[model samples]
Target: MKNARPLPSYLVQRYHGWKATTHAENKAWYRRLAEEGQRPRAMIISCCDSRIHVTSIFGADEGEFFIHRNIAGLVPPYAPDGDHHGTSAALEYAVTVLKVANLLVVGHSNCGGIRGCHDMCAGLAPQLEEKTSFIGRWMDLLRPSYERQAGIADETERLRAMEKEAVLVSIENLMTFPFVQAAVESESLTLHGLWNDIGEGVVECYDPDSARFLPV
Candidate 1:
């Protein structure tokens, strides 16, 4: 592309460092993964937050999880409307092709996308309310979540709840896929919702029994 540029110096150095050490150490395992293809046990849909390291958090290997990152980790409802659906495409491939046994929608603390949705819904962000804003349109998926948490009076509490609600919304939307429903009904696939408190270094899992997020 015309605007394309070489990798930054620090990134390049890091890549070389990783290639010489970690990649070298895991050469055989990497080779095996390449030859056999990936058979990930789970598919994780998470936010594009730099701090929330999914693999590091779980101590997962490269081939163990199929991860898709997007703003606020939001998942839209099953819409086969022929528009460009990156998240849905990834989900379909994970469920139908990879046959991942578990699908996790992970949300995290102080999510900018979630905050934007909160502000936009409250009529505080005019830019996000604009028709041409991609983030705005994408975050519309979480509008229901904002509305659901309107009863909360405190700003911090309401935003925190909205963050968790994003995970719920994604999980609920994931089930809308026909293949996902089939796999789940047959007990082949299980769904999970998770909220990670980045600063606190705590991960909470959604407990269906109590309908609450309990620490993992």
Candidate 2:
């Protein structure tokens, strides 16, 4: 019995149930989306953290949002020669092709990439250099913020500040894309900065009025 083939019972059952219900209730909707392609209303630039799910957090259904996830949700400034521009490419597709009305940069608390960048920049992780990893390169985007915030006495405060600064930087980088800039200037699209603190299940939006992340 132990050697007998095991089927993915839970997943298979759940998928079958979902498929039946969705096909019954949303067959037309699904067909229309498939034929016409997705016309998502918003584009979310977020971290690859498994806990930070944009769809679940926003209560959005399929085809509602175009999402781009990267390390620490960092968006590199427009560079002509940067070969690894996955985030930029996704942004272009969302803005130019999908024509999303809103672009959101969602940063989260307890971000591992942000913490790694902070530690590496502050010389707290000297052993990290031995490993030739993409994380080191990806976190390079936050180097400037790390340098500026290095003097903060409290590690916790410094990490928080870096996280916020990283979001602001990504927003600025988003403008570096010509399509994004044109969309914003033409009033066809709006940019937003959001922070999700998972531990407390608290979400904060960057309030331009006070330039602070306030609970939503």
List, in order, the clash count of every candidate structure. 0, 0
Q: What TM-score does candidate 1 reach?
A: 0.98
Off by over 4 Å in 2: 1-10, 127-131
Instruction: List runs of model 1 lying over 4 Å from the truth.
Output: none
| Model 2 CA RMSD to the hidden true structure, in angstroms | 3.8
Q: In candidate 1, residue 87 scores what lDDT? A: 96
Clashing pairs in 1: none
lDDT of each: 0.95, 0.89
| lDDT of each residue in 1-216, candidate 1, tens digit only | 979998899999999999999999999999999999999999999999999899999999989999999999988999989899999999999999999999999999999999999999999999999999999999999898899999999999999999998898888888899999999999999999999999999999999899999999
Error of 2 at 126 (Å): 3.5
lDDT of 1: 0.95
Best by TM-score: 1
